[model samples]
Target: MTDTAEAKRSGPNSPQTAFTWRHAGLAAEFATATDGTLRLVRLDRPGSTQRGGAVDARSHDTVAPETALPLVELTALGHGSGWSGPRFTGTAFGTRLAYRGHDSGSRAGWEWLTVELHDPATGLTAFVELTSPTGLPVLRSRVRLRNQGAEPLTVQSVSSLLLGGLPSPDTLHVHRARNDWLAECRWYTEPLRDTVADIHVDAHQHDSRAALALTGRGSWPTDGHLPMGALTERDGGGRTWLWQIESPAGWRWDLGERAHGTYLALNGPTDAEHQWRFHLAPGGELTTVPVALALGSGLDDAMGALTSYRRAVRRPHPDHTALPVVFNDYMNTLMGDPTTEKLLPLIDAAADAGAEYFCIDSGWYDDDTEGWWDSVGAWLPSPRRFPDGGLRAVLDRIRERGMVPGLWLEPEVVGVRSPIASALPPEAFFQRDGVRLTEQGRHQLDLRHPAARAHLDKTVDRIVGDWGVGYLKLDYNIVVDPGTCAPGDLAPGAGLLGHAHAYLDWLFGVLDRHPGLVIENCASGGMRMDGATLAVSQLQSTSDQQDPLLFPPIAAAAPTAVPPEQGAVWAYPQPGYDDDLITFTLGGALLGRVHLSGHLNRMSKHQLGLVRDAVSTYKTIRADLARAVPFWPLGLPGWTDAWLALGMRVPGGASYVSVWRRGGESELSMPVQHLAGGEVRTEILHPSAPDAGTAIWDGDGGGLRVALPRTPGALLIRLTQGAENDHR
Candidate 1:
């Protein structure tokens, strides 16, 4: 037997059959040998010239007994006890048993495959589900364990996904990111052996346990580390495998060498790692968190496939296509201190600058006191802030100016001094030991309770239905440390997971009832940013970094985790800034959801013109944004890059590029992937300064060479398909 086996299934005697699932160039083949030996025969983008390139081709299982690999790598309790990789322990149970049949089907552009395995001794049946969309190069997977026997079973750990088999183990690079408070999505790519191989050398010395793992803990989904990672074949043909855990609780993924091949195992929470354990009573079941695995020829291709899949999974909303420019009175403006007098002029100025939605962010309900933070939860108009005609007058003024009115609401928590705190019983809040949990002077609301849901529904309906507010900026400020413990049965972490799901359910219900309303998800500036939350919310606040200079990198890297149309990038062009600075700030947001802020009312007529110009440019490119895929000219941005570029390529042969020159060289060259080896007409769509920069198409290098004679400049370039692939 050879590493590259011919495309064929196992012999008739083998109960293990082959399943070759594919979408375009991407293909994943799984085979179960006659002896219940399951192996991932293929997990790569098959070459176009390969025979049986069809997505539905039969699996190629030709590995000998010595080379056969286990379908699952990790074992929980008694599951997979005969597996080769690391074993995750529990009270009892492992997957050392025989294989059951499988169920598979396809519909609505998606195909689902589920394999069942039973540990006859413990009567614990495990089901593994793999789902992939028609055009996406990715597959989503999760594991479910059911207790079929009369006795209850205590489970500790379960693999969310287990994938074995890759082309090679030589020189494999692990690509991941280290995320933090202000700095988010900073990526690092290193050798797989360097990251996890040496961590357990003593235990994995002469075995297939050379493991590398990445884990995330706490309530903030991406607070410690991003829920995404990638593995690339350094010496092989640019083959890349990417995975992301969409769980909000503790999650981990491991890459290891096993059975002359490589394997990837992903899971969320375990009794061994996160003190997470659950009891599955007779006829009860539990499921692991969802994880996505993608295969592609290159990083960009893999990321693009994931991006397309994201758009398909997100909750459809008009805001996605409309791409309305939002003006929020917070950053560089009111700063959570909005008043009737202060907002009236800004509302008028925002409408003049073409802002479609004017959001009164924060302090709108605060009764002109410093203790407002502890007095929230009661979403009512403040008499002191709106002395003359109340908040309705300001909201009416916004509608009169031809823009939708939006309000800021932190509905997840109630303030310690909030009237609702005593109004609702402690059962409506998160409790550990009969006492409500409080963080940062805020009490976390458990949406699993009907009272909490009713409180929020009433507040939102009053503001939107009664006052005609069409938008809501929902913010989550504090992290619910540890988690809540249910009275007797559920773990604290399990309680937290239930509450998170219920919160999202409430959000979906709001959208169901209010079909025309738009909601923005903000968590003290992207702390709670994840696909699950974004699926329900209309927009994601990229960050809360007030400095305009530090915003470009975040905006540039946002598309890796979020869609361009849903990523609300703030463009705060203040009256005090020069023309170039204003344009630089505005350029950071031109390619994403333009979130306008700052003191627009105080800006001069000339200064206001820049805001209007950027808004006008946004309107022109917005329609293209809804259908665009992101591309990076200079690769992913670092914390401080002198030159950063983000490109959005639409279906047609047209593309838009936003370049920011923080402060460095006058001339810089960036290679555009789409325009490579072709000539394209390039023009600056939004010029930050009168003499911003000149973009020249370099045919020889296959890149757009930009020359900016001035420092701190920005340019939005439009590249159109050229006549002949010419060079100048």
Candidate 2:
């Protein structure tokens, strides 16, 4: 059934080529090939800065170096050519790197280099890239290695590359960790109201290694590698699959839909973790990461990308949406004190006063004993907390008001104080001494075990089915061992001792069962947020501290921790002047999800009114805000202004803008591409302050002009018809 090389090569017209050095002493070249569809490269010698002397090319085996040293600089390139060989010439950078191009049919080319190092034990790397005849990047790479001195060495490394691709909006990011069909692991936002975009969409496959990955869009809820949508073959056999790898390498991504930039990076794994992490002796050590960027249509295309690059190219994918705005309220406050008599009224008031979603937090259980990680799976009413009891009755009460009902659960967790742990054998624990430690406070559940599997199934089935919970905010204050865990189940990228991926698989499975259900995956507050797990949850807890001031740091760091889809942010705003409210909501909106855990009933009547109005205004433009093009308007020319004008433009050029004034005077303008490069009339309006109401005709200068009062915040503006399409 396998086709011979000749048979496989016949369908397409291939290119032929070899390497030529234009500037000799400056750079040395070794291998090269060109075919319109295939390219190969190897550098026997590169620039002084590049690294490459002895390398291990064996598929899954380690190799050793012979002497005390090896040149770190080296690179090569290959491509499919129209003719067969020798029509490509190259340019060299000193004696360090070189690049070549063909003057004929093929419109592709490459540049290679051997990056050097100061410390011998540190590491070495190579940089390579793909270019268009017009000189735009199609792909780029950063290959690396560990200099083991004169001895053998082993290590784990990851390559981080940056690409410029399509902009991110309301898109999906998949999780690419391990899968444990048996474990009841799942994902969601840690903070109930902070950020809710961590929602991980399962491709419905149970193969842990075959899950979705984050595309690292915007900065919020989380950072590092956030999840993106899943990738199946361009066909049905399930041969080719793809996922995104995201990071903050300081590159801005703003490509329109049909993105057509050069490929940035495309490297594969040296070992299972997409890298090599090892050691070095008195004279030995190695450190490096290889990134890769690849594309193919068949199943083989997917597998082949993971293979072959074990020792070659390394690249990072482009970035996406980086929103930082969020909504906040006293979500889990009810959980703090489950006494329904006093809490229900408060929950209702909060819901009415403009809170996005009311979180029916914890504390409804019968136990004063329900603290921390204790009492995990006892999904029942605490006779002591609500003596009159009916959890559904309370949930129904909330939903009747036209707002969604969000409930909190810990499916992957079980407390020792609860009946579930005492019911199961203590031997089922993850081992403290040998008997498996079961603290009187909390007993950990081994998700990788069959016993835990059955337990989670029963719990999730009921909580999700019978309860009809829309948002499941699950928390794991403590890390649970993912069992002895199967292969490909380590905390990806980090390769930490915990079976992180195995747990991720279980989480996705549960998400697949509940329709319209949002999963909030959290780790002891700020812990567990990374490239792997972020992609699989709707939202994750960025931090446990809910202070208003802490927001900026979270927003700043968010871009580096998780992708935009999971960029939900949890904030506890200080209730004061409407300025803080405007500031909090506006800032949070710029980031991700926003949440609150304070008393909503205690606010001033004016504050409540303001909230009611903000929520109404927010809903009016929710659709436009949710899926609009994000463009930020600059503040006034000087003096510490807080009011911000965030505008979103639609395809045909219609625009929606929201402005929040903090302290200083507010005056700002936005420029648009509407009006076919000509002039048009503009008008602005706001319920809280002055309404410039439909007015004069002027060109598309500084968007619609806006002005705000000192304390009254949150101004909204809309732009309709404009100039020509090809006027510019």
For each candidate in turn, the TM-score is 0.91, 0.52
In angstroms, the error of model 2 at 688 is: 2.5
lDDT of 2 by residue, 1-728 (tens): 00211111111222332332212111222231221211222211223222111112222111111111122222211111222211111111112212122221122233333322222322222223222111111122343444424544333222333222211212212113211111111122111112113223244221111111122211111223232112222113231123233221111111111111111122222232222223334354232322323322332232223222211121211111222222223332343565667667656765776664556655655465536456556677666666564667666766676555676665655676678877766544454334453444566565556676667768777776887666666665543221222233222222212324445667767766764566665554544554345555666566554444334434323423333234455534334535445444434433334454445566666656655654455445544433343434441111123544444555455565555555565554444433335554343433453331222323535345555544434444566665422110
Cα lDDT tens digits, model 1, 194-280, are: 744444334655544447777776678788677888877676456677778877667777777654455677788766556566778
Model 2 misplaced stretches (Cα beyond 4 Å): 1-335, 350-357, 373-379, 414-446, 478-498, 523-536, 539-545, 549-598, 602-606, 633-647, 660-687, 691-714, 719-728
Instruction: Tell me the deviation in Å of residue 242 in model 1.
Output: 1.6
**Residue 35 lDDT in candidate 1:** 53
